[model samples]
Target chain A: MAPRSIFLLSSSRVHGYEFLEHAKEHLKEFLSKRKVKTVLFIPYAQSDYNKYTELVENTLKPWGYKVEGIHAKSNPIQAVLQAEALFVGGGNTFVLLKALYDANLIPIIRERVLQKGIPYIGSSAGTNVATLSIHTTNDMPVTFPPSFEALRLVPFNINPHYLDPDATTCHKGETRDERINEFIEYHKKQVLGLREGTALLVEGDIATLIGDRNAKLFLPNKEQAEFAPNSDMSFLLNKT
Target chain B: MAPRSIFLLSSSRVHGYEFLEHAKEHLKEFLSKRKVKTVLFIPYAQSDYNKYTELVENTLKPWGYKVEGIHAKSNPIQAVLQAEALFVGGGNTFVLLKALYDANLIPIIRERVLQKGIPYIGSSAGTNVATLSIHTTNDMPVTFPPSFEALRLVPFNINPHYLDPDATTCHKGETRDERINEFIEYHKKQVLGLREGTALLVEGDIATLIGDRNAKLFLPNKEQAEFAPNSDMSFLLNKT
Candidate 1:
């Protein structure tokens, strides 16, 4: 089987940058390495697929790649099968997963990315579905999917745009750490809390954290540990 | 049938107050009117039901009410049927809902509160389950229940401990308003964002906001609205 190449980003826009400005360099380099020219974009996370697709197209066009949304294609599965690369943008996780299930594209997309080794780029909600399940998502359950299970491309779950608790704030809501702890109490899987401006790049058995921020890792029955930028996180890729 | 009496609080502990201290007087008044001497506390939300029940018991001990945890009872449904009042505390909504379904308590609890008119009190996770569904909760989906369909005690959804967007923060996570909008976009139901320290008291057909702060209301296509302390919120009770 071919090795998987996946770029799971915490968010599209970061502090003091335009849309995807922070990750542009890394994204360009990743695509360039594979000589990927045409990209199939999944815009099902947003309510307006046309608008979302147009935004992605504009962004990728300037990077010297042609982008086409799966929504406009007559057959979404065929689009995935024929694509040079796949890009799934961020929005609502539940909406994105439901749409993938509705289109019956999860297995095909998984095959293309896992078996064929097609490059995959995902941000926020897209990053969420690349994991084992959407159980760690911060988004509201706007819509119900048939199940919380996702692509399972990764052994662990990803909590994208993970926020640190404000010690001074009087808010009584559960902190991000508390929520993650609650999740681990129920599910035995490890969860990686990817702060904004960070991305995890996986090449076969190797996984690395990229960007200027640190990522938090939560393992069941263990204290949360932090990983700095460019830290090797391949241990996360090991089977649970 | 007795008139329904319910207090749906945003949080158990508010700023500069001990656990349930700020809500003490109001809770006392609500229970006093109903002449409720005992409360069957549902502590399934928290992992340690015995400890959770102890906390509630200590808090309500001075308020002149006996508290018993449903978990300790051999028959949870029988305890609910015989209780003079019910109090569901805050923790994880998904956990609490799944436990309710697992123990087959939803139907009996609904019949007791809606038809028999037992005084019901809920805080945070508890408040989320009292509504039509748990879709608007801010908690993580650590576990999956049979369905997101809740007790349907009220027509509208409750978003407890609702927070406003930080004006100067660069975080890209969806704001509370944006999440609520996404939910309404799909569910066609009204959502009341209960700010910290506030609550809704329902006495039969009348519902009133009680506390120092204002609560925000989101209707599908209408401009978001706010309600001040003591403001009438009976419109939310009207069926969608």
Candidate 2:
């Protein structure tokens, strides 16, 4: 069976946290109705010795839910297989990628999340892993791992930490928009440019943007426009 | 002592070829007085082996200069150390990066080109390597190599193949400009947005644009503007 759904958060900025709160609400509702236990997985949490896991535990424990922290090695394939609801937190995308490759857990995690219907929630690095490839990650290539292949959970790419151009620094180098446009021009694939507080909630064949404001939609040879959150499923469906 | 000047081509596109021609002119002028020999390094020239090299060799041979093809493995350090004038052709940035890291050649190449002043030329992957990092490379992450550290010959990033928005596809993604803007916003670094048919020719502290038209310059928090080739030495000075 497919997991309940997949939630991709592009960043961990303040707005990203708010989106997490919204996701928590939905998860709580789903768990209450299903009468089942839920588990949140934070792979990068191990680096900080349960700092992230404790935060999630504290937030969800009051809702009568069971939260456990799986601090396995960089690759936690076994732990991922056993989790019901997996929530990956935000951190360095390159580090997360290295861990996934070192453990050879990319394929396992993808199968569990996509095929086993493991409701997965990812932010930052987690969100990057959900894409067809992690080529669009903004993190510097400080260290290269074995393979750049991502989870390929979605066909499009993800550009987290999407921000508007600062006119003052616009002349310093290639604007963020220009760099992403180069990718769009070359690949002609759909890429979700999620602002700090926005997310794409995908269930089955359905994807809805959940957040406070409209996210920017960029298409090849077209003028960029802002679309309200949860505006339409057309864009998501067309790409998928 | 630094070798004579070199030209870096951004791609093999028609525009890229035109830029190469323009670069050839400058290289010829620089060599005329000093009798400097020129070599074209086609790292991506895997199968079609003789086509690009022959073309470049034939073109420059008539000018009383010896033109040779480099067929070494992807060890960028070796390639840089052995050559006087280097011309890097564009193909796949990821592949080029993989080769550079596999041979552990990044640091040595950086030293030879940036510090020792080997006349360096790069286009496409070559140009991408000239930047602080390859985070803006448009290639997919099919495989991860050992390191993502680029030559960092320049302080800013490079966004080659910069194109305007297109509307024909149903794909929704971030624009090229937007992507670089995002990086600038996060890192406060400058990025050179080089359109097709544009090349950056650096000689000592002088980095000048060469080609048909002016290239776009993007800086964090500043308005993007077009500057004529060799318009100002201030930007290039800061980078060196």
Candidate 3:
């Protein structure tokens, strides 16, 4: 298998940051390393494709990268084939996966990232699809995709924008940790709880946690462990 | 169609309350008004059906209700048909709906509630299944049911344990309001956000909001509204 370059971002914007501003340096380094010129943006997660694409374009323009929306292209699959890199923006995971399935782009996108070694950038919902499935996503199922199956760029599932339980909260909804625990209770797969502002950058078989906050990992029948920023997470990529 | 008798509880346990403690009065009145003797318990949302049933049985025993686990019966369908009243306990909505689907009980249960006029009580996940679909649930997609389609006992969807945004948080994940807004964006259905310790009680054609807190209602193309406790919510039932 060819070495793959993937950036799974927890969120596009952290609190008090402009759109994609928190991820500026990392995005620049990843795209520069791949020598990417123009990036194809999957904005199907949002209702307004052009508007979403514009947001990404505006944010990345200063970084010396050109951005285009796949929705605008007459032939999306062909666009993927010719693209230097891919950027899937953050929004509802259900809507994003359903659009990907509707356009018949799942397999092609998977091939581009896994086989062709095109650098793939995913924020929130995008990060979700890059995983094995979107089973652990925090988004509501506003829409139904044909399947929860995703790109499988990574072996394990991811819970992006992972929030810890507020000690003072009185809300009775299951805590983020509890929800992940329930997910593992039935599906015997590891789930990485990617805290907000964190990103998992995988180059070939080596994966590294890329933020200040600790990333929590959950496996069935095992106590969850947390990884600090810059810790090597290559073991996750090696699983199955 | 006969008027459905239903209690859509936001949660089984509220903060500082024991299991079913916050809902004891509402549960007692609903079952008592219907003259229910033995309550059929569906504990599929949980891995341990027996343990879940016991918890409910213990909670309702003092209220003069005999709680029986549907899982214990030789014929689960027969159990629903013969149940004086039905109680669906809180847990994972995905697991609960899938088990109901696996047993082919969705139609039978709906018929029992809508046609037979038997009282149906739902807590959290249970409340989610009693509505048109489980799309608005706060629970993770821990497991995928065959479809997001759920029992159409009500015209709209209910988001049980609906939470308000934490103004102090730094997390960029979509808040509960944003999630419901996303659901309405695609589905065009009204979603009632049932806060913990709140419930919607329907008897015949009228539904009333119960508890001290107000319930939030999300409708497509309109500003979300909140209904104070004891408000007449029968308008929600007449939508379809």
Per-candidate iRMS values, in order, are 0.8, 8.6, 0.9
Clash pairs detected, candidate 3: none
lDDT of 2 by residue, A117-220 (tens): 77777887788878877776765443455666688777677777667776753122345576566566556665667776678777777788877756776665
* DockQ-superior candidate, 1 or 3: 3
Give the distance in Å from residue B154's predicted Cα in candidate 1 to where it truly belongs: 0.8
What TM-score goes with each of the models? 0.99, 0.58, 0.98
Instruction: Kindly report which residue stretches of model 2 are placed more than 4 angstroms away from their true locations once superposed.
Output: A15-24, A30-36, A72-75, A220-225, A234-240, B1-84, B87-118, B121-240
Worst window of 10 by summed lDDT in candidate 3 chain B: B217-226
Runs in model 1 lying further than 4 Å from the true structure? none
User: What is the clash count for each candidate, in the order shown?
Assistant: 0, 64, 0
Using alpha carbons, what is the TM-score of model 3?
0.98
Tens digits of lDDT, candidate 3, A1-240: 668999999999898889988878888999998899999999988888988999899988888999999999999999999999999988999999999999899999999889989999999999999999999999898888888999899999999999888778777778888889888888878899999889999999999999878999987774789899999999998775
Residue range B1-240, candidate 3, lDDT tens digits: 667899999999899999988878878888887789999999999889999999999989998999999999999999998999999988999899999999999999999999989899999999999999999888888787899999989989999998888898777888888888888888787889898999999988899999989999987774789999999999998875
**DockQ, cand. 3:** 0.86
Output the lDDT of residue A183, model 3. Answer: 86
Q: What local lDDT score does residue B135 receive in model 1, on the 0 to 100 scale?
A: 95
Q: Which structure among the candidates has the greatest TM-score?
A: 1
Candidate 3: where is the Cα deviation over 4 Å? none
Question: Across residues A88-119, which tens digit of lDDT does each residue of candidate 1 receive?
Answer: 99999999999999999899989998999999
